[model samples]
Target: MRIVITGGLGFIGLALCRRLLEAGHAVRLVDSLSPQIHGALPDVLAPEGAEVLRADVRRLGDHPEALADCDAVYHLAAETGTAQSMYRIEEYTDVNATGTAALLQALARAPRRPRKVVLASSRSVYGEGAYAAEGTGTIVQPGTRSKAQLEAGQWEPRGPRGEMLRPVPTPETLPFAPSSVYAATKAAQELLLLSAAEALGIEPVVFRFQNVYGEGQSLMNPYTGIISIFFNRARQGLEIPLYEDGLESRDFVHVADIVDALVAALQADVPPGLPMNLGSGEPTSVRMLANELLAASGFKASVRVSGQYRVGDIRHCYADLGRARDVLGYKPRVSLAQGLARFCAWAAQQPAYQDRLDAAAEELRRKGLGT
Candidate 1:
């Protein structure tokens, strides 16, 4: 099958390209190679025996040739900074929301449309995620935590009657409650693709991924990927900062597992237009993550929880993965311990990158998104 992957040069995209190519698929990678992810004047380290096209996802309409004769299209390009998205509203919307529109327009102009269009959605769309009232045991999808609540350090979401709530496995059934511009754009991308794909008689598969981390993730991009940022800081003997007392948790799925899920979606008979979550199905707190990563890196850097909190940050969220398991038979194989060790080993060989963590936080602070 002939496949085209947008943002194919990215960390996840490159991994997917390798797998598809190994399976004898004709793969073409389209990416803008943004300097934030790929260093300035990158060497274009794309996989061997695959076609590479330098193009922006928002302008894919102008390059219909990339989509022409494509059997499958994987939409994996987007601006993915949760805190930074609060301030860089236009850039996030233009790249993520408008980018999806352009992809659909390009498909509409294609000589032969693809059978499937898979989107890379996010768990952030389910802000605060699924929670349960402590006594009632009733599942609730809480709305965004207010600024006042965050200011007062009320970290967890509460029930309407002011009852305490506990985080649970967030399912696909939860409605969208985006907390940041980035999350909103991801929701927009999902809706646009799902609705338009049906109209075009194409299969739309959306996977809301949890926190994906592993080797090859961008170490210099401090605006996203907490694992990369933390690892980078630890390697450089810099302090690792944690926000909101460091109890907030995330489901950390490895990149290899993510790639496996993408391959499964292509071959498995997954129901069209139904969103499935791809994750490890286990919650790991930020504090636990910091300890594990620092130990794995063999770096001695102070870990600090400065009572700082970023707007649009969620208290807790992890994937249910029941739908994905039922539909695609997907199960993550890498444990957090193993994945962290692997990541640290690979990152150790790479050059120590400049820690941009402070600069990014200062940008958010100036914009009043962080405190």
Candidate 2:
């Protein structure tokens, strides 16, 4: 099979590319190597066995050959900064939403379209996720946290009658309630592929990924991936900042587990209709993550609960993996402790990068997206 992966040089994309190559499939990577994720003068080398296409995903129609004769297409290209997206609205929508359109157009124009189109979506589409209303225990999806509510330090999302809610595993049936530009664009990407794949006679598979962290994650991008940002700060003996009293949680799945699911999606017969959640089905608090990373890295950076918050931030959200398990036999094998150890080991050997957390936070604050 010949596979083309947009953003193929990205952290997850590179890992997926290597996995596909090892399976004896021809892999082609289409990536612009945007400076935000790859850094200026990126020193990245193409995966040994794969072909590389240097092109922006928004202009994919101009390079139709990248999609020609491909057995499958994995669309992973996007601008992925939740906080930054609140301000860089146009850039995020253009890259994530419009890029998908370009890919569809290119496929429509292709003499031979790929049979399978797999999209790497995000869990952010379920803003605040499913929660249990206090006392009644009814599962509910809460709305976005208001600025006033956040300013008042009311972190936990409340029910309509102002009842306190407890975070629960979010099932795919939950309706879309994206709170950020990044999440909105991801939802748009899902709709674009899902609605068009059938008309184009292509099978569509969407995976709503959680907080993916592993060895090759970019350490310099302070706006996304808390693990990398926290690790970089800890290595420099700087204090790790925790937002929203550090109790807010996320489902952190390792890149290896994510790759496993992606590979399974390729060979395994998945029912094409609905988007499936890909995660460890567990939630870890931000503070817990900080402590674990510090211990794993043998770093003694102090943690500070800054009470700071981002505008589009969710209180807590994790996946309900029932669909992925039944359909793809998917199971997350790497525990948070084990994955942290692996990440720390790999990150320690790499050349150190500057800690840009302060600058990134300032940028968010300047844009009135963070406090």
Candidate 3:
């Protein structure tokens, strides 16, 4: 199959491209290589028959021809950050929501439309709704606050069930109650893509992804991935900061597994308008992750608890990936321990991580914390 992947040089996108190439498929890459997450585009993506187009998804008008000759598209480009989205709502909408619409419009006009359109949606759409009675196996309305609220002076408002609210490993049927602007735009984009599929005879598949992390990640970018941040800090003997007691849990899916799910979605016999969750169905707390990282890196460091929580930060959210398994044969194969080992091994070899232990120690001392 001839495939086109937007944001093909990104962490997940690049991994997907490599997998497709190894499976003997011709691939075309379309990416703006935005400064925020830019990395070296490997030579495999530039082999004789491959094509690479430099264009932003938000400005698809400039590269209408990039989608030509492709049998399918994996849309993975977006402005992604939950906390930042609260302040940059318009930016999120423009890139995630409007950029997706623009891509659909371009596909709609294609002389030979692609057979499949796979989107990288998010679990954030379930938002506070995941805490509602309907979502938590209890009956609660949309706006009802959880009884176990965050303590006074906490940064964000607490939900019902207070900090004890546990997300029910959300399925596709969950309602959309986006807490952040980024999530709202992502939810809207999913709807728009499906609607366009119905109206334009396109086949669309949406995958709500959990937190993804792996190699080739940007350690310098503060908002990219928590795993990367922790590894970078630990390698330098810096204290790892935890938000809200470090007990908040998240489902962290490895990038390799995410790529596997994406490829499975493309090759499966799934129908349009189908949305599934891509995750491991395992939730790990922030503190546990820190311990895992420390053990993997063989580094000693302090953990600083900020006791601060971001607005719209959920206590816990994981996926009920049964649909993905039954429909797409998707299963996460990488264990968190193994993934962390691989990541830490690679990180320890980086020149940037050497000789920074003192600076890291100094920063931790100033904060009055250590592991």
TM-score against truth, every candidate: 0.99, 0.99, 0.86
lDDT of 2 at 282: 97
Report the Cα lDDT for candidate 3: 0.76
lDDT of 3 by residue, 185-245 (tens): 9999899998888777768899999989887666655554788878878777778888778
Return the candidate ranking by TM-score, descending.
2, 1, 3
Q: In candidate 1, where is summed lDDT lowest over 10 consecutive residues?
A: 265-274
Worst 10 residues of 2 by lDDT: 265-274
- In model 3, the runs with Cα more than 4 Å from the true position are 39-49, 129-164, 351-371
**Candidate 2: regions farther than 4 A off:** none
The lDDT leader among the candidates is 2
In angstroms, give how far residue 344 of model 1 lies from its true place: 0.6
Displacement of residue 51 (Cα, Å) in model 3 is 1.9
> Which tens-of-lDDT digit does each residue in 296-366 have in candidate 2?
99998899999999999999999999999998999999999999999999999998899999999998888
Clashes of 1: 0
Clashes of each: 0, 0, 12
